[model samples]
Target chain A: MRKKGSYRIKDIAIMSGVSTGTVDRIIHNRGKVSEEARIKVEEVLKKVDYRPNIVASALASKKTYKFVMLIPAFSKGDYWEIVNQGIERAEEELSGYHIEIERVFFDQYDKDSFDKQMEILEGMEFHGIVIATLFKDSVLRFTTRLDKMQIPYVLIDAFIENTHCLAYYGTNSFNSGYIAAKLMYQQIGPDDKLAVFRFIRKGDSCSTQVLKREEGFRTYLDENHFRGTIYPVHIHADDNEGNRNILDSFFLLHGDVKAGIIFNSRVHVLGDYFKARKKKDFKLIGYDILDENVAYLNNGLVTHLIAQRPEVQGVNCVRDLFRHLILKEKVKKMNFMPIDILIKENISYYNNYI
Target chain B: MRKKGSYRIKDIAIMSGVSTGTVDRIIHNRGKVSEEARIKVEEVLKKVDYRPNIVASALASKKTYKFVMLIPAFSKGDYWEIVNQGIERAEEELSGYHIEIERVFFDQYDKDSFDKQMEILEGMEFHGIVIATLFKDSVLRFTTRLDKMQIPYVLIDAFIENTHCLAYYGTNSFNSGYIAAKLMYQQIGPDDKLAVFRFIRKGDSCSTQVLKREEGFRTYLDENHFRGTIYPVHIHADDNEGNRNILDSFFLLHGDVKAGIIFNSRVHVLGDYFKARKKKDFKLIGYDILDENVAYLNNGLVTHLIAQRPEVQGVNCVRDLFRHLILKEKVKKMNFMPIDILIKENISYYNNYI
Candidate 1:
């Protein structure tokens, strides 16, 4: 009889009086085995109560795994560049384990570019995929295809619910907004008017992530019975003139608006505008610690900047995929990164991770 | 002739017309080798420009490493308990790689207990050590003997300067204090009176960590030209009546003290004191997110709690030692953990790491 917890396939085979291949076939339910051999193997399995060590099994298999990453092109800015750096670090660390990562980038602002990349990915064979789901419709369409092909994929940066994604590593946009509102509420009076800035590409809808944040911000204000009027204005991300025009009009209409909150990392634009105009009275809260935003914070133009650790998100995406695909480990569906609050004092330490 | 990067000791042995062991002996200067073989091996090394991969070398050596952890007993409180949990996680993860970790805990409040533990450790043979240096004099003595034995060690929770430690994974107490002061300064006016509380056992001197924090806090106030009167108080951690009496005397001497800063996790004592007196006007800031402190923060009694990420520190201490001893990697001397500012809103997310 096989010893409990010490029964390898060979041991099972010996106990069953069958070939090792027959034991393997019986265990994995793959290939054909004689009924008598199968019955004996089953009996041995029940007697031993053998549990496989998936990690050891994976290491011993000696099979190479290919992971494909579909992310926004690094040409966008330091944001994507930082994420790419994290992915590269994970790739290098896992290289000795016979895993290869292939990166495919698409223009973040263009649907057609994303579609083109998705088409390329459809023809490629990979064990798993890691994607930055910026374009919702495109990602949903591609994820459907990925599901049909039985290819597991993890999402980063933006999370969409009711999707077939194996897991997601990103921020909870609504909660981040709620946190921003809480910080803002602490510094502002009940009667003070507030301005909200949302940056989007021309003719493009504001991303679901941004919209959720705005909604959460509004929810907090409404729930707390905040008496201040909230004036929200959207400006094109690349259009300097449009940004200036929107801000100027909003300030002119509500001159008493003492504090402003930006929904995204485009807070630098507002910081620069405030500095040029010499508006020292306005308190600003923004998201992310991009260089420009931090500079603005240092200069006292931006009062508080909420940080989402993009690098940690990137690293976890690769690690989660590796665990699921190679080690047969079950992965959590959602991994929400901590919302880091960075003022001028603690930003230096936060910068060390990237 | 060996290639530039692929020169192994086997190749060196072949070139020197000796056994690989002889080549290894020549390379490491560990064992006696014939003069001719040493000279030939040196010549082959110079010719090939061989650079050894320490990780691969350690793996191939098949050495089992035993690491000893010296820290305060977990029975002290949640702080040490959290740290022990982190160490356990690392031990479990590293067990597969033939690494064994033995924990030795001492009484945090008693120097003699620490010394006794050190005496036991001196009689043991361990490859590496991870220590929480609670008692400075005792730790210095043990570390001196450890250096003589050539056993590498990492420090956690508290860092001592100019020590023969492989690395330190902990908070920079002074900087955390400075950050705490900065946050306090923003909320209180320059004319306001501020109270500083340091809790300890009766007749116990405040730890170097706590004193450093107090120094940093004073530095910020002096540098910023804060016009506030600073009230410093110390209370016995377990003596509730003594804590109340001390606080009452401080407040009666300077009733204008509108804000208070506690230098350690025992801020909960002050929180309980404030709640019992129904003092709503005082703004309180403290260090750590122990259960009582978080409850106070949630109830709006504690305004801010600076988190040193003890669990992360624990995990990193073990990981750094593993890299230094087993992988032969050069670890940086000081690893200052991020000072996490926890308000009630973000505490849920921060709680997920442990």
Candidate 2:
């Protein structure tokens, strides 16, 4: 009955002496069909062994899909804005397909805000959801609810383990850290002391992303048998005085530190501190293409940037959701972004792509 | 008249007391309409500010578009095969949009083969063409013919200047070279002699892409005031005995050369040569993610590979052609690819994206 896979719905219809619409309705179990037509279509279907393509059938159907994107609120920092722009581009490209995107923004610094938004989303109905944030506990609880509701979700930017996500689209944080260490290794000697800066808000634990990066950095140093002492400094990001105090104490304690690697995007804070003191000898490597970081990179104060393209992450989040929900396409579990090594000369091209 | 951006074909059809199909036909200048319907649509077109989106209209129309893709023939070297995979992906995505892609292959090292393919293409009619090759003279003549024929074309993999191409999708060879130099700079000193290796066929001149990369590499060295003498070595790619002889001579003359940069993807040849001799002191930088090169990178023989994603380039070549020909979207002149710096730790993620 399966034959050579050359039989289509039209062929079935022709064989059944029925219209294609009638055959489609019979196959989909939608729309009323005459008994005679239904029986004829069923007979042809059974004889021809037609297996419908779920993706193609879904596309052929006139069904509207709604996708909700949960992300951090826009701020003066252009990172999330660029990400939103990527989502908008996907929305525009998918407009003709009867797909709608609803954006829900939560305060990046507030776990309660995320919980409140998820509560509101629990009351609504959407085919799929895309989430991008670092609120681990809240996301874990919400994903439990999503699991109970059988709603598929995708994670962007930061991935959490032990969760049932449709897909994860982001950078491999540990690998990025390992590569950052390699870049720093090129400039430093075996015995040269290096500083690891982790900037965090007061009372906030370092993000899993940042922690993985630090682990990767340390692992690289260990595996390569580097004799350098790694001085770890935690700066309270919310208080300038506290940050200054931490930096001052770190410098006084580790005056021999020749290079620094920031585990997060706030490398500019250290760059500014170094610049103000006219410290030209210390080399730094950090993450992201935030304006301050790029400025520091151009100033030669920040040597290299490990760019995990946030825009690409956002775009793929929406695209993967579309594929999973509307097209019924199989999505890869992990969509790791390229770890882009950005310098002054190549930033323009990278910017254009993003 | 232009009150707001709210005019649509349905609105015109409503006001003009015509069916939407009639309005569409009148707007697109397709499918004959009654004289009365035509007059009404024309009057509405004159009165209200209605600008038909050329792209949407083209998509809505029943016209089928044909695109020709000219690329190097695939061999055991999977570079062009990956590119063809990208093109095939695009074709599959655009299959429902009435777009047909005709792929024509040319021998990589033969100008006559390219010329023959171009002559055949000139005789046929295609809406657009995407070409990837560095046969400069043949391309210039073919592009002139394309210009006279009013066919828009795109260049991928290698870009030529002062052509009437719709867009160029590939790495900026010079910037890639400069960045490669930067990567090398991190591992070399002021007086350390470096060698530049260009591997080409016996009779073929150095490709424009390779030459530009060499220029960029030299420019970086000059701009930074490097005092090292650059030894340039050209090996006939097809002659193994000749390549070994040349490498032996190069080593004998420049035994102090501690670093080398390959201007093309054939860096694996040199890597193998060096590895067979148990030479581990030379830090090498090369281009592309060809299998042998990645193996060398994993084996720690190749320090870095500058990946100008051929797959991404091929994908964009088709997409940009679609935008220009069918969508009537504004395509940027130069679509420079990001110079992806690949090390062992991050190459897996980059490979996944590719």
Candidate 3:
């Protein structure tokens, strides 16, 4: 038995017959020590058992870094709000280190908005940037500028593979798509017809997440050997008229479709479409937990939601940025967020931040 | 916008009329250029946009580190097993860095066993340590020695104050207790007398999670403004004879007590007690998802079992260790695992790894 807090580095040094400076240098990894001395020092220190006081270390350290987040603004009932909450929580926790978070939100629905935001960002100086890869052209241009400026940045929610970015942290789109497909595959028998509804905007910027998800969903069905007629329909997500026209034409053409899967955030329209038509038995699965989607889930219209921890993804983007710039640390090239399967029974327990 | 991946540091240097060596030195912080040169270089670099390739950086960097885990050994169930799973996952993810994990598991039922483990650990070398602080005396000695040695460690599952640790990641015990109390509180009305059982082991190491849970459960009653008499009983968790004797006498003495709560993992014995008597409808709440407890929960004997993400905690412990050791990253000192409320209807959905 030993008294609490009785151990000290000086004691280890004294017992080992080593200079305190040598011990300090070894602890801090300050170089220039003989191999024999280094081994002897480490051995004696291990024998005594040493642990650093982290609180004192934190307080004594004067390192501070700024992490900036540039992403889509949180609209009413949008998923980005959840992501903002996660970012706020991370910011509060990291406040101890004097790490500052500067958030800049742009409209995902508009390309000019991204360019406008980029123009503003070009004039400012930041240590690191965490941006959602929403508008590819603007992102590439901004990230290219960031690269030239030697400012480290991480991509969140979506990634652009060809460009040089510090790191990427978001959902593994393919795995999540596969998980969703598995769920649907289990739910429906081999004889049932399946439809994948992708709400694509006409002349809109491409979203890599949607493409990856569609590819993954298709791959699952192919791999699982499902013997059913599969149909895919692409409609403008933001245009209700476009969605209705395409859906109407498709349903009229193929009235035998028993189940539908929406590959992206516009699943709410499917819910609205199905609910209005009173098509109760058509099994449906989609992405996210929008209020409209939750309403559909509660009403038993939506069978499942393949949720990406968008909030944690947002916060981690900032955290990773700080790690790269402030700590001068090596950032991971790709970080896949967990794919949370949210059902009506379990949605209430889902972490509010996510 | 700009051609994809066409930009590089050489282009920026060419555009700026500065030597590539000067630009590379500036980016890597070699510190030879004048202030005017640095500002001029930064301006041109920003105009053309140069991004460092992370793939190149990851390939070029050479670093290796050691992470050690000190936790309780897997006992009758998967309490520590889930955590080990998390650790192994992190190890796999970090395998490319030449990083290593050295795990030393100690007996939870014996303080002397833990002390011996600590003694053995004191003789070893590690860059970081992740400990499940189950015993006070052993942990205090271990942590103090670690502090003296200037080795940073993180606390998981259980935490102690007035000591140095890099970070703590576990569930909020008091809040969990409050949740337990809430669960049991809902089952019984104010007229009923409640009992809290602490399945103790005379001289063995017990967790503060138990005590905090008890406190939180009690506080729930106080906060909810309920009127109920609460009785706490402590008995050896494994002593069936002693437990039966104590319960028989206690029931005989306090016949009015209709509901009970186990602030620890001894819910199985209570289930066994009830099964022996063939008792029905006495409100019960316990902890974890052990096989015995799961049987009880499924049999309608246990009303609510509060579950922390045991597997996630285990996985995060390793990830945290790696982040601290390899990346030189600072981890959160106290990461409160999500306080998940598990019900029969939602348990399956909540079981996925985070």
Candidate 4:
């Protein structure tokens, strides 16, 4: 049974003594009808309030929206995959619209993989692009193409400088680092060293994002009159055996460095080192809520995980693109995810959700 | 400009060499069409892919959804107001649908005010409801009518027991309190006293949510085999001068109770007390991100604010109501919110746009 004050089209048609089609036509303003039928429909409509459809009208206009997300290729349940899950959620939301979203993969560490994806995308046509902006030089080339093509794009994971992107949706790397430093500094002494882990892939240049985080982390420590040394430790991103050699030697060489912070989502790499050694004591601050990071967090090896809302970024990239391109709405240029400080007590509420 | 590999109904009609009306009829299966025209539309349709619209089809079916959110009349920038903002956001998103949500407010402190609202609601009908089940007897009486009317309703803020409510959309109160205790337990010793603040309103009995929180807080301390005294301190929800007298005496009497935790959103009451006193040091853990609470948090009085995403609760309560009632979608009965631990460093990302 319908609630009071709610009327169906069939009910309105019955009240107006006409077919639902006549009522629908009068309501949508699409077709001609007899003046008598129109008046009858209008009389019923006057008592009712109905809003015209949103994206249905967009579909009616017959414009197809193609949005592509250029991101790193990763295994299931990794950082990028979680971001993809959010994009998939948004894709499900806009499934009815004449809109299509394609995810293009690149090797995060390999410039060649990135360049391959860019070359493949060279012949592609899209209404908008959502690029992860990982590799700066290669992205400069691709985004320049976007600028030349005049296709509005959003930058995710990093905020690239001097770009004409429609928006940037990611963490403020500096603030995130400052916050992570705040957490780490609370537990450490003025003389205790903090190891900043930078997991390296082949031929990978340090991103401006990572460097900004390092700068912010150092700035916080330096401003606090930290007498301890803050040193960088670069480890292989994929090579587990080689990583063991690097980390085992580093920890053995600098036993004073108990407090550590990884600037990337691969903080689990350090966790893996500890996991293999069967020791779960580390004041480590890492990034992302990946299952690996969380498992280490529960095991008490990782103290705090500063999270950027990748899922939110994924969802907003698609939505904001639609708003700007299809709905012609003005969009914000930068949208930073919140710096979430997750401890063992508070991490359950924050499982890949905004 | 349109993206590649997408088509509109007009384009499909053009592809089929038929009028848009014939194409629309075949796409929507609305009207009787010539078999030849249908065949032509089918040929064009086979080359394209489209998922039918979600809510627009509900509109096409012509059902009006009337939802009512019966909540406490709160001041601007308060908890309920933030929830209203989330609800308003959802309302804007659903502006194209045939649904109208009405918010009815009542005096939170007055049982008569609640009864008066119940009386007003008695004459009205709703397709579904989102009620802030505060007063137990009053909600029990009101929900009995809902059961009689066969109208589904969702619970917000506090999950009342033994109610036929469709779902709950708020923090798991017990877990929230347990987490708060963990934070407070970090600073206090077994010999130290912990004050559990219960801000009392007129004609108010302790809510089940608050009691569960109290139970959880004590259980955590007890589970740890603590010898600390955990006691309740009842103060007025309103009477400021009386509250000042009560608190001044309580502090004078028990100087050992430096650590405090307020279970409900009205923790700002204690913050206001501290603000007036210009006291910047209190190991106080409160709930919600009220401006008063956040200001005190910055000033170093309130240490942590456990934020239940009232805004997210507001957004979901409406959307879930629509999903269950209008869209006929299966909805889970218990939708607990993430218990967000808001500190001075992590508070920036939480400006209520979740």
Show the colliding residue pairs in model 4.
A62-B8
Candidate 2: stretches off by over 4 Å = A1-18, A29-66, A96-102, A110-127, A238-255, A351-354, B1-65, B97-100, B119-122, B252-254, B351-354
Task: Encode model 3's per-residue lDDT on A192-225: one tens digit a residue.
Answer: 7989886555336767787787788878888888
> Better model by TM-score, 2 or 3?
2
The TM-score values for the models, in the order shown, are: 0.81, 0.86, 0.51, 0.82
Return the lDDT, model 1, position A221: 84
lDDT of each: 0.80, 0.82, 0.74, 0.81
DockQ category of candidate 4: acceptable
List the candidates ranked by lDDT, beginning with the highest: 2, 4, 1, 3
| Poorly placed runs, candidate 4 (over 4 Å) | A1-57, A62-65, A115-124, A137-145, A189-193, A228-231, A254-257, A351-354, B1-54, B61-63, B188-191, B224-231, B351-354
Q: What DockQ does each listed candidate score?
A: 0.26, 0.46, 0.03, 0.26
Error of 2 at B172 (Å): 1.3
Kindly give the stretch of ten consecutive residues in candidate 4 chain B with the minimal lDDT sum. Answer: B1-10
State the weakest 10-residue window (summed lDDT) of model 2 chain B. B1-10
Give lDDT tens digits, candidate 4, residues A2-78. 33334666788998999999888987888889999998788777766544444447756767789998988889778
Best candidate per DockQ, number?
Answer: 2
- lDDT tens digits, residues B1-354, model 3? 233233566766776678888888887889699787688789976765655655345424665567888887886575787678778877766554556688898866667777888888877878888888777666777888889999988888766887788888777788778767766765677767988887665455567778788888888889877787988877675689888888888888987888898976668899898788777777788888777877788787887777766777777777776666655567777777656555443344344324
